[model samples]
Target: MYRIGEFSKICRVPVSALRYYSDLGLLPPESIDPESGYRYYSAGQLPRLNRILALKDLGLSLEEISAILDEDLPAGELRGMLRLKRAEIGQRVSEEQARLARVENRLRMIESEDRMPDQEIVLKELEDVPVVSIREVLSNPQDVGMLIADGYSALMPAGIMPIGACFSIYHDPEFDPTALDVEIAYPVAETVTDVPDTPGGRSFERRVVRGGRAAVTIHQGPYDMIDQVYTRIGKWISDHELQIAGEPQEAYLTAPDDPGGPVTEIRFPVA
Candidate 1:
């Protein structure tokens, strides 16, 4: 039998961690000295300690590891748990990759701070509006205009009265030019029940566009150059130490196909 300190050295685990495991009934010592209150572990417990360390390296919590070890789980159950852990790790890796990309993008924004647009950005409370929306996945951003037109045409036939400019809600966690998930919606005053088929062969559903504190900005020009506006707003939000509270909305203020000009107002909810 080895004392707790000696056992810790053998297992390459910290003395405090061993005591914690013992306290949690995960790796109790084989015997405890009644007089001195010392903890002693047997060589046989080394395998269990190794298992705990291995699972910890896989990002399993102590409580989960304790349950897994204490239950003497079957081989199939153990394999399934490991598989789930593997998938979770994969998802974490993807999230970290995205985070790294965002950090790099922020760095680029800082480098280009000199050329940032001087567009007027304002904070305002946008009132809630009811909308009939058609959500679809697009292979490219250029399809947004056609999809919005189709939505309007479908809604017009259904006698849906539009109150204001049509807007779109970006659903993708990050902006992707190659593939996008967006909801094109038109504000309506009257409650309508008919779900009209969009030009893209999708059904429109009624939903409320939540309103709150929003950082609003206008971009006048083509839609292709809108990324610059987005980058500017994102930088402004960060500069003010504000948190994005909800999804972004882009209200089209001009005709989508008009060569004259298409002005767009971008609103990002902030807290």
Candidate 2:
């Protein structure tokens, strides 16, 4: 048996924490002297203390940890809870990484603002193109690639092949990266009827992407840096006194496996 301070040293936990746990009935000492009120913990209680510390590290609340310890929760249920916490942490890390990338990109752009080259902006009339497409609201912009890949996989089995580049139409009136309203499409020579939906539940439909006079420019780098091109286009539109008439679209010109990122043509309908 070891006194409270000695046990604290052995377990590498604070004596105050041990006392608090005892008060909460989480890790009570094995014995206590009634006259002098000294708490002693036996080596047998070490396993229980370790379990409490492990659960706390897994992000569980004190109340939740107490319930799990007191009720002797099943191992399977505890494993499931740990898995859920892991996924939550993973999602937060992904979001933070993306946010950090954006911050770094912005800083770089600001530093090079003066020496930025003028991107060529073309104004031309586009003809109507028929396509097979799926429109969905995505919670994360990163998922757009998977959605496009899934669309192609679904179409290939139906003998539908794209005659031209795959493209995406931004349907939202205002840009919202977190909840993007996008339409992924593949241009077909002719519209086919009754195409089955993707296995992921996105319904495929045949539609004509309306065309009009548009301002277009090509972006040839990471998608995260595409915003720089968009900024130039917006300035060009303003300088030319043109008003945007519809949602923008991006046509991918390179294969998905391109190591340097896809070369994309961005178009904005204008009046």
Candidate 3:
């Protein structure tokens, strides 16, 4: 028999942790000192403590670890749980790698910030998106914001989802920013038009958020001054031996509506 302090030294675990494990019924001692209320663990419990530490390192919850130790789950279920854990770890690893790559690219840009020319657009085959839309006219730029919020609110209750960027199609150039007819949509199944009298009308089509194939320029500024962003993109395209093919789409990475952080990002579809 080993006293709690001696057991802790052998296990390299804190005394408080052993007490906690005991309280949680995870690793109870064989006996206790009644007069002093000190814990005394058997030499046999050392292996059990090692297993608990190993399980903890694998990110298993206490309950799961207890269940596993108790042999409550079958082998198949255990394998499935381990597989899910592996997939989750793989996803996190990929995300970290991508984040590191972005940071390195940004560092390079910062080093050459002064000599860095206007942004260049890359062409990519835009994926097909299925969207249900509501045809409404925006009274002003502010109304665009409200309409989007209202659409999200209305669709959330109905379970419609937005995929990438929530935006509008300018029906006419004369379409007033003060009074513009815009369609707010989210990519769902192409056939999910009818919702037994949904808030928005039915009849969705396969429309690729086109013109993304054109060269794009990123802008970091307020939404009101976004027109200057367009001008910069236009100049960049002209200078880079590219031509305009489709109308510009402003994909909001961040918006000026929020109090903190700079609003940025607009994509110009060009030939």
Candidate 4:
């Protein structure tokens, strides 16, 4: 048997930590004095202390480590827990990587142009895709979200996940401030036979968006500034001697409520 101080020296863990672990019922001393309240630990307890420290270094919370140690958890259960931790860390790393890329791109843009361009348009060939969509004549532009949500909600029951970003296809040749003809669509991997009805009793149908050549540009910031991006697209199409062959599309690349900045891809079909 070793006194608490001696045990702490041998295990290389502080007395406070040992006390904390003991208070949590993780590792208790071999015995405690009845009158003076001194604690004695056995050399055998060193192995348990080592395991706790090892798990702590692996980022496990004290509570989790306590449960794992107290229950003498099975190897499979421990592996499962570690797997979940790994996945969570991996997701964080991926998000950081994307942020890093954006930072690097911004640096390059500033160095080359003295400032970032308002909008950079490029031609891209969009491929045909299967989509579940809702066609609506929205009373105002603000109602776009309602239609998008309705389209997604109606399709969610089919258990099919969207393959890409949610996009809207404008059907009207010219713009109307109060009335808009829009088809909101979410691309899905597989087509569903059964159609679902929106909250307003409109049928959500599965259709293939045709493949075509279009000019695409990413708009960063609020939706209110999106019209400027469309202006650039129109100028680029005319410079290339191309005419607008079909309606414009806007694909949302980030959450609408993102505080940093929301990314929107504006595309116009050209021939």
Q: Highest lDDT among the candidates is held by which one?
A: 2
C-alpha RMSD between model 1 and the true structure: 12.0
Query: Which residue ranges in model 3 land beyond 4 Å of their true spot?
Result: 114-166, 169-248, 251-271
Runs in model 1 with CA error above 4 Å? 1-117, 257-260
Measured by TM-score, how close is model 4 to the native structure? 0.56
Worst 10 residues of 4 by lDDT: 190-199
TM-score for all models, in order of appearance: 0.55, 0.56, 0.50, 0.56
Tens digit per residue, CA lDDT, model 4, 189-258? 7645566686678887788999799888988887897777877778767765679988899998887677
lDDT of 1 by residue, 33-150 (tens): 9999999999999998899888899889998898788888889988898899999999999879856866675577668884544586777999888888988888988899889889
Say what the RMSD of model 3 is. 11.2
Q: Candidate 1 at 262: error in angstroms?
A: 0.6
Residue by residue across 102-150, what tens digits does model 3's lDDT show?
5565567678784555554444545545665555666776676665666
lDDT values, one for every candidate: 0.87, 0.88, 0.66, 0.84
Candidate 4 stretches with Cα past 4 Å from truth are 1-116, 257-259
- RMSD of each predicted structure: 12.0, 17.7, 11.2, 12.5
Better of 1 and 3 by lDDT: 1
Q: For candidate 3, what is the TM-score? A: 0.50
